[model samples]
Target: MAENIREHLRRLLSVPPGKGKPVFLFWLYFFLVITSYYLIKPVRDGLFLEHLGSGMLPWFYLLNTGLGLLVVCLYNQVRRRIRAVPFIQTIGCALILVFFGFRFLFGTFPALAASLFHSWASVYNLVVVLMFWSFADDFFSLDEGKRFFGFIGTGGVLGGVVGGWLAGLLAEILGSANLLIVSSGVLFLGLVVVQILGMAVPSRRGKGLADDQEGEQLGSGFGFASLYRSPYLRLIAVVVTLTMLCTTLLNLQFNRGVELAGFNGDELTSFFGSFYAWMNASALGLQVLVVGPVNRRFGPLPGLAVLPLICFGVFADGLFAASFSVLVLGYGAALSVLYSLNQSSRELLFIPLGIEEKYRAKAFIDVVFFRLGDSLAALAQLLLVSTALFGAAVLQVLGILVSLGWLITLRVLQRQTS
Candidate 1:
């Protein structure tokens, strides 16, 4: 009966024989990583909103962008010197310590802690998630990526659901600061999983690369220079930048709407938690029922196009009705799609690139360029709102315009990928 169940799961996830253990390990690794992030995400947002308020979000976004660059650059350097497993282990230990420190400081330095934690959380997710996918890109072949990435990504969606649910249930009972301890514990578990995975499947480098080469430094060149030389990477960077701009604008609007609804303290934390839970739950369903079949049948083009189209509709609706419920539904829908189909497809794009492109260049694109979009959005908000030159309607219009641009860029990317 147990063997039958295992066989069923293998069939459902399209896991070929001999690949089950590594796939399962990778799935569990991603599950723990995302679960850890979601566990603290609500707390991070709530503390920032409660102590700093929504108005200061732009400055925080800019600060995050600056810090993200420094962190990713340092990450790229370290990744070059160490093997993948030890590199991740070192980062994981440091992050656990930081979380513990934040928990201790929250009581005495609420504002200062909140400010620092907010920036750190933004960079943390990017670094951790990028590391996971970069390693996966190296480990899996292109054909395997298409067959298995959707199933692998489902682990993250499930983690988001579980983590979000726990955050909502525990915030009021355990207090927001205590959630950091839980998050750290979850991250430690992820590190354990990583160690086991390394022992199980030590050779994660691409074809023709020796296992020992995994520890050698990557080719000496800036990721930006590589990004500039490749038209494909350039297009990807632009599309990603646009996506983040839309996300940042929607987030600002969502936070304002939540504030208008008069939520604060634990109530605000719980609200954010519940919101993430519902969003991830929706994503979980789509990942199981939609992403794999769609990617297998129609290919990743549809996955690539879905979010921008959803954002276009959502932004257009916001022009007529900017209610809290509308923003909730709209933002939730966008994020659900983003995390499920869109995310899997994006990672699949990296599978065909060289190792340096996969690790160094991809890190730059995911971290620095990702935050570049947020910084631009924040700057736009600061300039327009502070000058009273435009209101929320203008931002909606901007989202609509950006969505159109995203669609156009995807077409170009499709041609190149084709």
Candidate 2:
């Protein structure tokens, strides 16, 4: 069994690229990544709210943030250490399969499917982000990235929508906990099949010139300092940090909005799951229509700057809607659409960066910076709630004002990158 597994991985790593097959494989794999996330996140957030309440949401986010940092920080070092593995993607595939397999065969023994799912979901979030973006960087050069990232990103949106709806529908039928386990088992089975027979990406198409080197140079124990040197990287970090604060608030509001309706447990899980699906659906439309065209026509800075402005609207409207169910839904809807635009456009920004900055530096920003922002916002949320310093409206006000400053920073960053 071990030898066959090794052989399967060997084949997956060595397959040659001809037409668009390599890119297609990337889409297929990343689609599964997002699907896994969508399946788990709604339930994770809903479960956290049900068990721990709004106070705990910040902590749960902090947990995710920490996990991302740990994985990304170890990534290069890990690959280098595993000299025998040769192909790290195979190791990832094996890990994915083994975990899922354990849940399936032993799910009845203890630690129900939902328990295993949560554990795996925690791991999956960081792994997928690192893998997919690394693959994206591998396949698309700086010049081509601008043209293709929007379209490629759609795979994630579609996967999110599918995963959310599936989890919700499954919850309605089998219960959230049960369905979560089933999703895990099913995901594992799918991965096993793919690992065994999935076409290998041709070696040449899958690696950058410097990809094989894993050392202290890029992002070792410390993250990429060169990213800090790039004007664009600084602005990207600032803008994303601001955006993270807004999203953190929005995420809390979402939980609170449901609580305002008086919900918890499985019912809350189902509703939030459905709500997430709807948001992804809305985001997909904006990605297709607004994100790419706007960037191509207006240039990268405006493409990038538009997000902070959208975040301003998101915060303003969400505050008003915080008290009203109808308004809250609209607020959620607007954020969904705007976030997609922000997401697609942000991926576009990676094209202009240097090589080390794109993979290592960006990974740091995604994990460390993102988590730092979330942690800060979460702490702020607690402090404000405890001290009664301000209501939702005040937080909204702060978010909008800071976003304006972020927009100015983004303009400067884009100019430096250009």
Candidate 3:
């Protein structure tokens, strides 16, 4: 009966025949990387709110934007020399060192230390996940991606649940600062998973480069040139930008709500952590039980449309009240739907592109353009907050408008890709 149940789940999840091992390895990698990152995410949010206040986050977002551009440029250069796995390992090592440095400095100057960690964590979370997608694109065929990507993504969602719950449980005892060491440990374990993948997957060697990747040179000029040249890429950039705008606005509002709810230190950390756990748990269930079957039956369009549709319905009802429970449910629904359905669809959209476009141009879209959108959204939010008149309500309206644009972009993108 147990074996039969296992087979049933395998079929339901659309696991490809004879590809179980590779899929599991990919799942493990995704799980480890996201677990490491999510462990820090809530802690980072709590620290920033405690030390910098909710209003100052726009400055950090702007700082992250500039730093993200620099990192993208440097990453493009570094990828020219090193393969994907080694590059990931190097990043993990550097983050481990940085966490230690933060730990030492946190004793004397908490705010400055937390600020630096916040910026770095933002970059770390996006870049690592994007790199994994890039690696997967190089290794898997388009057909395989459509079938397996959703299932693989569930691992990350599950990881988020675990990491968030663990952080919540540990926050009181370990404190938010010590969570840095825990994050570093998980990241190192992720690197070890990468090494295992290096040995287990034969075609995964040499940075998971595709056959067409042979002639592509590394002097890609931040990938903006290709992005400007391709209409498809431009549309994707716009979608990313608008999505970031909506998310940033929602996040700012959520943070303010949390602050107003008046939780501090360990209480704040645990609250955010449990909130993250619930969101990701919902995302995990959707990815496992809904997204894969939905994609198989209807295609990526429905999956792509889910988030914007949810946003339009919820945010359009009334003003965004800055309260703990309301923010929890609102942001939770938005994030869960976005991460489960929208993210899986977005990653699969890259499958048909060339290797250079997939890795380099996609990097620009994922890292630089995404952060640029965050920066712009943060600036907008900053201006609204400064005016001190109906800031949260206006932001909710902006989110609704952005969601409408997102739906239109999805329609166009589907037509073009189809």
Candidate 4:
């Protein structure tokens, strides 16, 4: 009976024989990476609110954009020199050290630490996730990606559920600052998983050009030149930008609501932790029940369309309702789709590109462009709020407009890819 159940699970995920070990390793690797980030996410936000307040979030967003560009540039340089596995391992080690360093600094300079940690957390999550998918793109063939990426992505969703729950429980017991140590340990475990994964999938490396050849292919353009050169990439950039714009607007509104509700310190941390836990729990359901079947049946284009349509409805409703519950439902639903269907679909789009473009261009789009959209949204928020020129209803309208733009761009991209 147990063996029969295993066979049924394999058939459901469409896992090819002899591919189980590598797929499971990749899944575990993603699980560890996301788990570590979720642990830090709530702590990062709560500490930022406690020390810096929500008003400063926009400046930090701008700071994150700059830092994200620098990191991607550095990442491109390093990636050109090393194999994918070593590059990921090196990043994992560096992140572990950074977390430990922050843990120490929090003792003496917490406000400053909180300020810096916010930007670090933002950049850190983006970089690690980009690296994982870039590596995955290298590892899996296009046909295999269509078959397996959704299942692989389910690992991250499950990780988010577990990590968020642990975060809520741990924040109460360990206090928010000490949660950094716990995250550091989780990252260290992630590094170990990376090592094991590297060994288990040794043959998958070097599918791209050799180190020197890849560097030359990447050229002096770094990543921007690729974006300039490719219409498909440009469309993706626009989609990402509009998506992040809507996301940032929704997040700011949610944070405002949370702030006004009068929670502080660990209570605030616990609240965010629970929020993420529930949100990711919803995401897990979508990943299991929605993403795979939708992608397999209609292909990724339809899956890609889901988030914008949902956002459009949610924001359109928000314009009428304009309540905390509306913000909660809207943001939660947006994120649930974003993390599940949207993520799997977006990563599938990269499978057709060349290795140089996969690593360099993708890093730019995911990190730099992702943060560019975020910063622009943050700047817009700051201006509107500071000037009192627009109301929350106006922001809702903007979100609705952005969602429509996202849908239109996705339509164009779908046509191009088709």
Top candidate by lDDT = 1
lDDT of 2: 0.63
Each prediction's TM-score against the native? Answer: 0.85, 0.77, 0.82, 0.84
The digit string of per-residue lDDT tens for model 4 on 7-105 reads 787888888887877887888888888888999999888888888887888888888888877776787667655777788888888888898899888
Count of clashing pairs, candidate 3: 0
Clashes of each: 0, 0, 0, 0
Tell me model 3's lDDT, rounded to 2 decimals: 0.79
lDDT of 2 at 158: 85
Model 2: per-residue lDDT, tens digit, 1-418? 9767745644554433342454455556667767767776767656555655665566656666666666666775564444321344465556556555644533364334444444456777766666566545654666556545545577778887888888777766775555556555545543543453234543235433475544355553334576546766777777778767766766666566676677756677677678778888888877767776887887666766665665676677766654455445655664675567666577777876666677677767776667777877787777776368776666677677777777777767766766
> lDDT for every model?
0.85, 0.63, 0.79, 0.82
Runs in model 4 deviating more than 4 A are 1-18, 83-90, 134-147, 198-203, 207-211, 214-233, 296-302, 313-320, 345-364, 389-393, 408-418
RMSD to the native, candidate 2?
Answer: 7.0
How many clashing residue pairs are found in candidate 2? 0
| lDDT tens per residue, model 1, 238-282 | 888988998888888788788779886988888898899999999
Give one digit per residue, the lDDT tens place, for model 3 in 103-123: 888888998887888888888
Q: lDDT value for candidate 1?
A: 0.85
Q: How would you order the candidates by lDDT, starting with the best?
A: 1, 4, 3, 2
Write the number of the candidate with greater TM-score, choosing between 2 and 4. Answer: 4
